[model samples]
Target: MTESPASKPVPAREIISWAFYDFANSGYTTVVLTTIYSAYFVGVVAAELDSGEPGSATLLWTLAIAAANFIVLISGPIVGAIADFRASKKAFLFASSVACVAATALLSTVGPENVAFAVLLLTISSVAFTSGENLIAAFLPEIASNKNMGRISGYGWSLGYFGGLLTLGCCLAYINYATGRGLDATHYVPVCLLITAIVFAVTATPTFVWLRERATPQKLPPRKGYISAGFGHVLTTLSHARQLPDLFRFLLCIVLFQAGVATVVVTAAIFAQDVMQFDSQQLIILIMVVNLTAAVGAFLFGFAQDRFGSVNSLVAALLIWILAIAVALQASSEADIWITGNMIGLAMGATQAGGRALIGQLTPVSHNGEIFGLWGLANRTAAILGPISYGVINRLSGGDHQLSLISTLVFFVVGLLVLLTVKEQRGHAAAARAN
Candidate 1:
């Protein structure tokens, strides 16, 4: 069932359904990872245990996120190989999606007294979210034409931002209601987490129902066990790095720059809270603007990547990230913070869409899950390194966020310099030959 370049045309219905999964999962990413619950984890949920110690809550939260990413990094390629061999991407997607939704909903029960429970649920949900992302992204090559891969990836991302906007809107509505009722707004966090889970469940229905499995199950290679085959393929791919230099090189760059990008995302609310003294509502508003601008960026840059090529498009976006963090480090006013956030949104949207599309372009549709597993490895590696580094820096600096912001600039610069070695067409050809 692995597709050549001439695979049958993908239905538009299926494509839209596939994109809706992005719309669904993004609520968790924005609401939990970047905005509301992240702040709650630090300022409220973990507040009791840490006894108001500097950086303790942030460190705990970072370690939980780091642990989740570490799990994904180790396991993604193996699961990806099995899914590819079995042509059971939908099955993997369903399991991970349910785990994520359940964990997200269960987060509602965690309060100040049970920081351990909150961290546990966060770790589970983060792993499920990332696992689902790897599988869903594997489908890109199945659905898109080479010419429109960037645009289609952008479509998914732009739509994802709108989902974030809608989820934030829901939180805003509830916060307003709570305030009018003379209630503490922060206590309403568990309820908002519940709302996020429901949104994801409702929106993701179309993906499970409409998206077709394009890759048929293949026989196990002679004498190979599932786990062995999985690890073997990954090792073989690595050994042949010279043959797939662009893909390998792209992964190297991803591990570096994505570390910087994810650090900014996970720390943005904290930075705003600590430096700008933003309340929950203000932080939510700021994230909403970032989501709005991110949608615009995805729409604009989706095609820009197609026209200019993924490597070039990604390089430009990384420059923006470098500039954004530099500005954030220097900013002293609310206006300056706003400017930095918007810049981050633009760069994040473009780089993510371009990076996914670039992988689609380089990989064969047949071995997609395995290759995208590599993508997952890079992504989660960044997830682990970025948050841990930021957490450590915050601890060392006694929560001095400006110093942490300044440190991320180096990741971007190094990643950009390394990215110059890739040759896109060669990677595409090599992947095709391997499949």
Candidate 2:
């Protein structure tokens, strides 16, 4: 009898450490990027800007996001190639994570009137966060065996959601306590940002200590023009993409679908403040609920992927996203916010975890960094469009957030159609062979 791939076990400690990086970083995604800092930027920092400017705040925010995406688009492939060549994946991960932590901690000092400071800090932090995410993703192949990759990826995302959930809960409690005593809850934003940095730094420590890189570190050629090297890598990856049809298809799906996901993250705080009239405490609660629910969804979907298939799980997650967006568009009250938030939680975890698993199934270990770099570019560059769409629609419609949210559905539907054409099982088989 042949031993099944599913019967093999990965090192438990390494997997845990790798997943803990997600746990640590999720706090930044939750507190800074998604809820508190975004709201602070738009409502406080940007609000203080000169008056009579047409959509100036939204435009600045959009540009910041675009700049971050542009950096990722240019640098992701080079970083991936370097990771592969040097086999210094862990070192890369540590450096990027520390950058993120430092950037986030620096955000603590940006005051309400400090729009320039806020923009600079947030942009740097966003770049670091996304870059670190790409590095962390390269670790999956090291920790999980092929058969259990989907479940393991899901577990990591689930744990991340839980971490976000807990942090948001703490933030909410502090906000409520501050507000009740007639103190300023807004001041706590920086404090929370600092805590997020510390937590990420601490949680990510284990990954650096434990996870072993499979490839040997290579000596990079004497520093040529960095910009030229970056652009060359990007061009090569883009041209090479056509040679891998399945990977191209997967990249396309992720590019479109993830745009919607990224838009939701960037816009949720704005929606709550503008539409639902939520203060900081209420907004924190909403975020906490979503993260909690997403954690559960991640675990469940991970199990489902193992039992059924990653493609199937991903398809179902897209459908859920469509429904969640529709519900969010129609939400008029706090109760509606709760309902939609819960639905988002379920869909968000499945979308991220399942997507990673599917990508893992399609990529060769030797090319993991390069392919995942393309994946990062696709994910982040595609994100640039959604925010632009939302900002444009919001301005045109006089802040009609419902109409703005409808734009997201197009991404999900298109991605779903493209994904439906994919032969997932065959793709996975090919990926295994390439590995």
Candidate 3:
């Protein structure tokens, strides 16, 4: 039997390169999904279609996000399987990155009148973005040891927040300059999208250059095509999931908790803009601060995860999320939101970093890509359900952002309860045996 790549002496450079992908991709989420374009779409593009109705625009945005994530949910496992069979993780990653960058850049062409165009481009870019995210994550177990997985994953996530911060900062500077000269969202927003694309393209290049394809290619079975094989792999793996009970159980927790995280990722700016009357400048600043706190949280919790345990670290983070949501629900001023949002930021980093590390710990090295694809599936499932749920609630409440926001609390609480059942040591032992 061939040795798994997980046992290879992975260099620090490969790990850093792997982390840089996180950094590279963060701009897309920060500028396009989280900070700039989501609010712009809500306040401008879809608003034009809905005659400035916040609920309708919000719903449209969430629907577009849900649609994109739905595609990811269906395609992720298959793509991962194909990459595993063909040893084409880098190829798939590169292709997805190109698609995402090009689609995001073309977003510069979307005007207020082009609501459908906006949604179409957003869906394409979002699909590409998420596919790439899953592919990159599939590299984690290959590059890190079980003991240090949390710290390594934390490094990636912390760097990712910095990447987001830098992207948002540059965009904010441009926004300040453009608005200072009397440019409106029409002129300035396009430039921000273009900037995000350029940054994504440039920053992500190092990942391709430095990251090695460690998986050995598997020979195709007689008469089996890659696609069919891919589907077969997914079904077979899922059928055997009971053997890795803790991993599957944790995936359920991811589905539940990640719903809240996804909702916040897509809706934070919209919530602030609509509920707190935050201007674009204020929104960027708020998110930048959040990014800073998130980075710090990831860094600190990385060590904490190693010292304590993945489950414990994650539980602490979820509790913080519950508190953040509680504060957000009752927030009556910018200061209140600032406080709660930063708390969320802290928890966001810890939860994401800790969760990925735990998955890395629990996953068999040989099935790295396929398993992470399921991770993506879990996350994409949350993305689909969470934002749509929030959108529906907001619309039903007649654009009540506060009420809609409260739904996130339920996911966190339930997720926390589910997480407690994940036997981390048992999961790790199972993966080690599989190896």
Global lDDT scores for all candidate models: 0.88, 0.79, 0.92
Please provide, for model 2 over 214-276, each residue's C-alpha lDDT reduced to its tens digit, 9 standing for 90 to 100: 665544456755445545556766675545567778888998899899888988987888788
Instruction: Give the total clashing residue pairs for model 2.
Output: 2
Q: What is the lDDT of candidate 3?
A: 0.92
Model 3, range 1-435, lDDT digits (tens) per residue? 224545578888888999999999999999999999999999888886456554888999999999999999999999999999999999999999999999999999999887899999999999999999999998887778877889999999999999999899999999999999999989999999999999999999889999988888998778999999999999988986778999999999999999999999999999999888999999999999999999999999999999999999999999999999999999999999999989999999999999999988898888888999999999999999899999999888879988998789899999999999999999988887876
TM-score of 2: 0.92
lDDT value, residue 182 of candidate 1: 85
RMSD of 1: 1.4
TM-score of 1: 0.97
Instruction: List RMSD in Å for every model shown.
Output: 1.4, 3.3, 1.3
TM-score of each: 0.97, 0.92, 0.98
Question: Which candidate do you rate higher for TM-score, 1 or 2?
Answer: 1
Model 1, residue pairs in steric clash: none
Q: Which consecutive 10 residues in model 2 have the weakest lDDT in total?
A: 1-10
Best by lDDT: 3
Candidate 2: stretches off by over 4 Å: 1-9, 49-55, 218-243, 433-435
